[model samples]
Target: MRRTRITAAIAAITVATAALTACGGGTATGNGGNKNPKTLTYWASNQGKNLDDDKQKLTPELQKFEKQTGIHVKLEVVGWPDLLNRILTAASSGQGPDVLNIGNTWSASLQATGALLPFDDGNLGAIGGKQRFVASALGSTGAAGKDPAAVPLYSLAYGLYYNKKLFKDAGIANPPATWSELIADGKKLTGGGKYGLAIEGANNAENIHHAYIFAKQHGGDFFDASGNPTFTSPGAVAGVKQFVDFMASDKITAAGDAEYAQNQSLEDFAKGKAGMLLWQAAGVQLAQRGMKADDWGIAPVPVQSGAPGQGTQVDTMVAGINLAVFKNTQNRDGALKFVKFMTSDEEQKILNGKYGSIPPVTSAQSDPQFSNPEQTVLRQGLAKSAVALPQVAKESQFEDVVGPALKDLFADAAAGRPVTEDSVRKRLEKAQQQMAG
Candidate 1:
């Protein structure tokens, strides 16, 4: 089982949103009060440095919205997992915010909540909608391909970070260009209480991502033609094998590798206890704090040992925050106006730059902050080479099912009794059926 790694850096955004207080009304910035005092309640997920610390960019925008519209705005930031519960709790009681940020993958799930506004042509036009965002983001946010249910906020993707010094010391002149080389280098770097690769073996979502990239290398798809789960294919089996084998193989993973989580793996690599790992672009900054850039370098995930296509898992750390006038909020126009301001190109520029995120809008990619070499490559991958996780309503259940299964597989493999390809395929096939049913 491959663990799908969720970046916890976003936790602050989701956690701070639990606080929502006061609401008031305001006039349109230009026009006279279209209505009485308009109060807009805006909820956002956590952003960088500190949730409160990052408010300089947003509070000003809120004030601007208020001064122009004559509406007072209440701002609340929340963590990831709690965001949905808070929204549901508020919505059920008719006290939800006028706007709320949701995970991009949660777009479909939240849309099922029936509490969000659909970005129809008229509304989309108001905010420089879909056209401004990347196509993948647009695809992820839309339901039935008509229009997006949420506005794109920021974007993220995974990249390979390696210990440059380790590779040089291993008598390797160049980084791996193929998956076989990656494995070979991993083997060479093993021993001395260190690891060659730092995959999150115990994290199932991370496993799925690892499988997805490997399967794609063999021209395999996660869902069959009809969008049904088909995770038992030859390619998928092979992918899973590679993951289990890597952990089980001597010198590849640490003795406690299966027990390690995402943070553990990152710490190991940052401390030079590991050779390489797949991480979001943010890891570059984390590496700088503990290790020098010269000590670590990044590259795209390598191609399959001798397989096909550019198979890399481009992980995205984006969530679409949909703004809707609660059926009970009495301030529909004011709410819509506020959303328009936040998604506008000008504001998006500031958000993407200072927040260390990418705007869904494709145009935002051109911003200098995103123009850095690493960011530029990540943005490109999101469009041309990324594979999205299965965004089914049962996504959480899917994660639960795969997590322990992969842990068991990793343990078995590490003990030199890993599950065979044939057995893994059969087991995953049954799991897919359960998920489908």
Candidate 2:
């Protein structure tokens, strides 16, 4: 999942610094016109089971880089909770790692700060040209057809995970292929204190990702071509209502599940308390939680069937992290070298394999491991129907505003209170107003 921890306060801080002059163009020249710096610092995001795990896996790669480039390197693995705040502070102060990893969802937002070096034509050519990367992954780095501020390093896509045993017990021969069928299957599976679906209602990022998929399935988008917010569009409203109705209208999920975060929902599924869940490559976590390989199955998320002219299926957000170079670093050339090394096909294999995510490099994506039965469905969905979150400067604000509105609606639904389409529209309209301000 693309976890955007950006709160209103953080959004305000980013907005305040948006006007700062961007350090554009070529890498900074070395002292006295000499090139080749001796050292560089890299801020890596926490990708492994823990921070130490990340260090264990990356240290060897960094050593290889140092040996190849003669540049000493310092690596710091930042936890997700602190990474964004740390990057924002560094951007504003012009002090941070020479290179760093950023959530793909934040690419456009951070690019607007002028704190990162743009991977323009020259820089991209130095690495391997734009065509070397997957088109969908590259499309997420920044605004369309513009010089991207970052490059994709790893990739992930959501899948619908279900309990095979649960389906069999419910007399269902196959997983649901459409929303209506999912609800029907859910009704059959819900009973005897077990739920049919598990939702991360309290986690803002999780909620927004599902909301995005639902909106796209209904032929709606979060923003129009002109970058105007369209959260209250009929499609958006219908999508969100479908999400919230799991607790309200369907009654297939628990009323108290509005408090569920991503982990909690996963825990419920792992324990067999819930029959199905929508999650990203969580196979590692599921195994860690004591779930067996044969116990669960993965499939593409159900689409809105019978919608006029809509495609057969829609999947989750095109999710992953990107590597970016800070604009103010003195060792620009060294940092660029480091970025090239990290995204190299070899390094992509090592990092993505160890982390249980797909490599962004086209050649590396064909690895045998990625074709495991569990991942095959998700990879196919990504190739065909995975939608990237809207790449807008205000994307973070979109999360900050709509997340709580959805949360509140879920809370009310869970409490057996009244919820109407008008209420959903009002919440979305208020969010639009907030984005306008």
Candidate 3:
């Protein structure tokens, strides 16, 4: 999300910053230097059920780092709502943590600031070569042909989650494998006060993620080669309309979903009010909320007609967090050491296991813990079918603008207003024009 979700991408600030241009090479600032080799600061994105959980879980690890490297670490867990804004403030002022976790979707946008240390061969080699990371996980780190602004840490991919009991009760034998089947199954599950699908209609990140997949599945992309917005393109409009139709026309999603900016959809699915959910690595959230492993099952998010593939058949967005270093950090060596420690196979297994995410490190992914059915579905999708959001300097702004356009459309759909090709196109046209201005 901007699935770091829709809650991520960025917190909507009315006077949003303008789009930035990618910088050609590494740039440094004077605010950071080698003045504090024995200490480092980190801004970790909120990955646990709450901020305290993150701190409690990470404290032991930081202690280990301090013991091993003699570096005292300062840790701050920033909520998704404020993470990007805080990072942006730090980047522009050259006053930020030594290291930070960024929503993978923001890689290129943050890269353009030139405030992050790009992992060129030397930097990458300092930790482990770029070869140590999963190839697909590497896809969203930054723009193509440029040194990555960050490296993969905790990786995730969306999958369809369905209640096993609901499927049985409805006499549905299997989860839907295509759009038609999904809608059909949805109808069977829609009665008795239960709907077939749960969605985060007002979530910008979730909206953009699904819209990106739907667009590509219909054989289109949001940006051109030069990274220009093409939101009104036929495939994009059709894609968005397809998403809205799930509620407006198909009647699978509840009308109230149009106002669900929080994780109400997941909660709804967990409580058995909805039969299915489309989400990224939902096992943790569901488990914490009291849904056991046997209660639900997971499958690849449906494709148009056939199995998911690397091309237009893509089904999920490459969603996760990236570990990055600020270019001018005082303790560059200490920060890099911390990165290596975090991405280490042992740590990857421990950390990703705790967070219910797939390890981006190839070796760690082979651990038996991740071999479960749910992990298999998510790992396979991330490796074979998921597509990264456009890696552009304006990618963050795109989410800020286009995400709301869909939000409004979803609102209209919930209000019993018509959702049409023309309406979707007009909204997209406005979104694109905003990009231009």
Candidate 4:
């Protein structure tokens, strides 16, 4: 899930989330998925470079599960573009996998549908207990003060990744620590065919993520305590404007980046075509792309003022994948067993290690294998400054509406159109209107 902020643009989730109705036949419970308890259908998120890659990595693990439990897991690696839509469909249609992976941010929205098996005290106890999961990770698993709708699997937080060699070549000693510094340093690094920063301008999720953090940096909150949309608040308007200015005014980000939806910005950073990127847990991805670990440095995402911390200095969002079971699965026991197997310390290490994510399971997180510089910074962020996106039931609706709104603003900037606060507020106001409608 890469925190749900670092992946595909979840277009049209408005439709899927709107369609949810507890479960099949408008009831909170209905039978679906594999009929046999000895077998389970699984829809894993596309965490690897591609669907095939995820299949290759997970097959052996699935096989091991089968060998140990005699329950065969039939797997389908679903890509980001369609993962949410698919799950929502299953939740409403009474036809889906018994076990699936969801973006942890979706826990509340899906929980509202009552299609997921709630990890209450008893259910969580059956899956090795709730205390094993990280507290921050657990914070995003549904709304506040309720049993988690899903269990945390892979945990992540955003950070700024910079090319050390590029920095040295540009006579820069350290990464920028503030927004102004980032923009100024970026300007210096923007000559000749290299840009100072790479951005996913057109990706809806990416756009909303940056906006959310920028808003937090300026005392902005996307929703009121009652979960009403406040998208056009002064903090939000400034936040959206400041993020887009990297392209519109700062010129450190390439205009062509407005067309980027795939990991082109990431590719640019990894290939040294760009000097920097704001990302989540990218260590394994960079290494896989042949960039040496020593070639780069990781730091907290730049903030508006002082060091990253609570309130205005908040930087990253709590990100990662969660394991969920469909409420109406016929193979309930096997599904819970599989969840147990996946969250167990052994598999937590293996799966999160391969995916370059921090394990949400506390015992697994302490593994020395996860003690590298990147993981260290991310763990700190998670512990100190990272915030989860609003944990409201309509949170997915927020992403669906606001994310595209930000994408449009980026497009305007890329097209050399005016991107004033008025325009930003108007765009967000329309989004709020959509939410109200």
Candidate 5:
């Protein structure tokens, strides 16, 4: 569900130091006792269909806030590829937005930099308190028992999307509920040169996310409670093997799929060339590409039935964006006020409805628009089984190192090489070593 396009810029210790310097070496605490602030700068993530679309959707909200609070906001919509770099640069230079949008997974990484304000109990009360947010969504903002550096603004989750026509043609009566059934159904659906599954093997971020979910379902986690990597654990090995098996052992996916990115995989599924795809709420995009509403069906991701430590089904990462206030802001009160307004019930409904995402506020989830049939399955998955990525300082490293390692494994499997448990463990172990160093 991450919309990231991998960039070469690495977030290192030096980068964190620069960000801290930019923020004046102190925790952000309400404009240093100045209660009234005039204007605030806001950096928003690009979530609309186009770059300008986000601006259009947010401009009205900004105007509304200005009218209500008498505080004007200077808005800038940043693209994903440049957003991280911009934030880092601003953090180092002490010159950035007063408030900003960040990927939920980046909360821990950015919080470690000491350049963002922590939304502790006292600060959180200003925005209608901690009770306002969905508990699961709020859980992703920081590590266990810590005050979050950000707050949930939007929510998303993964779902198993299948081509209904293809399923009927294959005589499959239902979507899979277990890994074994999924593999078997895939085999039956694969024929006439089309694949049974579409995989974003080349996209490292997408690959790592799937790896995380699969590993968790198998009773393994990428990082232990203390943030040390466990990538080579038995559960992790089993989970990664299952992903690789889609192309290797099960043969439900094509060799070229090893080169497929997220968009390409979605394209293949929409074109009816792949029977199934694991993706977020992508029905809007699918419809734009000529796939009718009735052409596809959505289900929860399958789980490993008998894997050790497997409790309830673990389906997806609590995927979405969060809003954060920068420590460097001179107008902390103004920034905090603006943030509260953005997450209010009216704003959440309008923005989330336009962006095709779920609102992060618990009260907003009850809206009838969110309960539409097209989004029902994904909503159910989020409420029932979705888990967020480990809220660790090394979260980005997990994506950077382990992601590429898994990509290499997928490449090897696509080349018809024998992918053993030993092979998977070796790659994961190498990633663990890199993270430790």
Candidate 6:
């Protein structure tokens, strides 16, 4: 996961200043008419290769969208670290793209600014109504109970990926289905400087995803249906205990793992230095290309204490980017059309197949590769048990706070310091107040 270069406080201040400078009220379009060769700007986050490679993957499809609608799209891909500043600056100044791909967590925050045009129009329903996509995927990209603030593009979900050979070597015939079993397996695998699990206590993104899985397993969450913070509940305590204990427990995660994030864990796992890891689907390719074929395989995350809902995990990156029309776009209709086309069933299938992402639409699951027996495990797991993270516009800030906050608590726990619900609650309460600001 990429770390923010600037502190959240400084970043927020900088973004606010930029937003203030960018503020303007103008017609969605300029005096120039939306005619023959209207160009629509679209900003997206950096994914593969560089802007060039992304453009290549999108050029043909974009051309199709433009040719069909008589509008050309100018693509701009920015790295995640700089994307927030760029969008806020452009949006406040009325200079953003006709359509933009924003991180799902930003939807609520950006939408709350009232700078985006809602697709309450017929365009959203025409491509695929809200019902066509996975409810959790759609929910994650929008204001949870409100009209969707953004359209879902592609999905990502995290799972426990294990070294198959390690399990076989330990005489573990079946994957661990519960926390108890996981610990037992960890004991069997740990030795010779090889730990059983690799977790990211330092990376905020990875921490949030891990927190979600743990909280869900213990039957707690970051927020209730009303969107209030609930991070100190008993379930949350259990979740945190399990997470911290796994890292501190002898023969499991190393005590020094607090300084390591997902990247370190991935490198360790890819190098076969760890027996198991929780990570995104992208790790599949990394492990396959980087490790022996028979060395590793993927599995649903383990459950808590052999309780019901075995092998459950919360899905992140399950949320897809929504292409919102900037209120300042000169071609709102064209932008809307392009948004519809980019998230259409055809385009979704193509992107998901090639990019290793889950399609935003439930029907897109029909694509044979996604529906295959091997892939079906994750698909069904998501469909049956997946919960979307809190979609409150303030979630990005929430992440900024809760990540470091948890790191502090988990680090202490790993170092043999007492960690109680009160300590966790105190930190979370402080974070909640900061986000409220």
Best by lDDT: 3
Task: State the lDDT of candidate 4 residue by residue for 254-316, as single tens digits.
Answer: 888888886788889999888999998888878878899899999999898789998999999
Q: What is the C-alpha lDDT of each candidate?
A: 0.62, 0.80, 0.86, 0.85, 0.81, 0.67
lDDT of 6 by residue, 9-28 (tens): 33454455345435433434
Model 6 lDDT at residue 288: 36
The regions of model 6 sitting more than 4 angstroms off are: 1-37, 49-60, 63-70, 126-128, 255-257, 287-295, 305-319, 410-423
The superposed Cα distance between candidate 2 and the true structure at residue 204, in angstroms, equals: 1.2
Ranking by TM-score: 4, 3, 2, 5, 6, 1
Position 371, candidate 1: lDDT: 76
Model 5 clashing-pair count: 4
TM-score of 4: 0.93
- Model 1 misses residue 72 by how many Å? 5.3
Candidate 5 least-lDDT 10 residues: 1-10
Query: How do all models score by TM-score?
Result: 0.76, 0.88, 0.92, 0.93, 0.87, 0.81
The pairs that clash in candidate 5 are 18-92, 19-91, 19-92, 22-94
The sequence of per-residue lDDT tens digits that candidate 1 reaches over residues 116-145 is: 566788777776655776766666674555
| Residue 89 lDDT in candidate 6 | 60
RMSD of 1: 7.4
lDDT of candidate model 3 versus the reference: 0.86
- Show model 4 residue runs off by greater than 4 Å: 1-33
Candidate 2 clash pair list: none
Better of 5 and 6 by TM-score: 5
Question: What TM-score does structure 1 among the candidates reach?
Answer: 0.76
The list of candidate 5 runs beyond 4 A from truth reads: 1-39, 48-53, 66-75, 306-312
Candidate 2 structure quality by residue, lDDT tens digits, 320-408: 89999876667778888888999998898888877778888998887788888876876776677777888987787787778878898
**Best by the TM-score measure:** 4
